[model samples]
Target: MDAFIGAYLGVLTLPNVSDLDGELLIHVGVGRTVGIWRARHPGDARALFLFRSELGYHHHGVPRQKELLRGAFAGMHAHAHRWVYELDRTPAFYFDSITQLRMDRTSLG
Candidate 1:
């Protein structure tokens, strides 16, 4: 592997997350990206990327971030928007569930 991206939030559940080669991706700011693969597949669970901290505090203190995330996947399948209070503290990560996201410590500032 290139290097284990720290799971500051958690681990990746989706097997193909590391290889978004043929998927259509969307820039979600904060230097993060969301590859839309199974956005709204009827009964399938929707997936999106996140900055570990955003997933950790989605309901605690980031409403605007939540709104932006929701807006990003509004008609599709985004859960919420993630914003940071400390820009320098933000870490690169991907959301797999509501409680946590797949984190990469090496990608952090």
Candidate 2:
């Protein structure tokens, strides 16, 4: 897992991250394996959380926006999008929008 995180961060490091606010958050993990990681890192928050399982996965926070999540993952070769939104006590509506935008951007090469 250390290597995976390191590689993931290394990829992110090369990108131009001028903003790190309520933007999209992308995470890749194996099916239910993400839950385990999330359990260990409870402090982390995401607007959109995409979990990929052999059978399928779940999209929490926003139900109607599942299509957007699928579109975001369409091009990726990975299992799913593990998006984390930092609400910071903010409302759910606002955070959901922010998460979608971040997910959209992260999907682009």
In terms of lDDT, the best-performing candidate is 1
The lDDT of each candidate is 0.35, 0.29
TM-score of predicted structure 1:
0.25
Q: How many clashes in each structure?
A: 8, 9
Query: Model 2 TM-score?
Result: 0.24
TM-score of each: 0.25, 0.24
The most accurate candidate by TM-score is 1
Tens digits of per-residue lDDT for model 1, 1-109: 2323322221112323324444554545443444434323232222354433333333333445434444433343242222221122333323332433454565755
Displacement of the residue 86 alpha carbon in candidate 1, Å: 27
Q: How well is each residue in 28-60 modelled by candidate 2, as lDDT tens digits?
A: 544322211221123433233433323222234
Candidate 2: regions farther than 4 A off: 1-36, 40-62, 81-95, 99-109
Give the range of the ten consecutive residues with the poorest summed lDDT in model 2.
6-15
- Clashing residue pairs in candidate 1 (N, C-alpha, C atoms within 3 angstroms): 5-104, 6-103, 6-104, 6-105, 65-81, 66-81, 69-80, 69-81
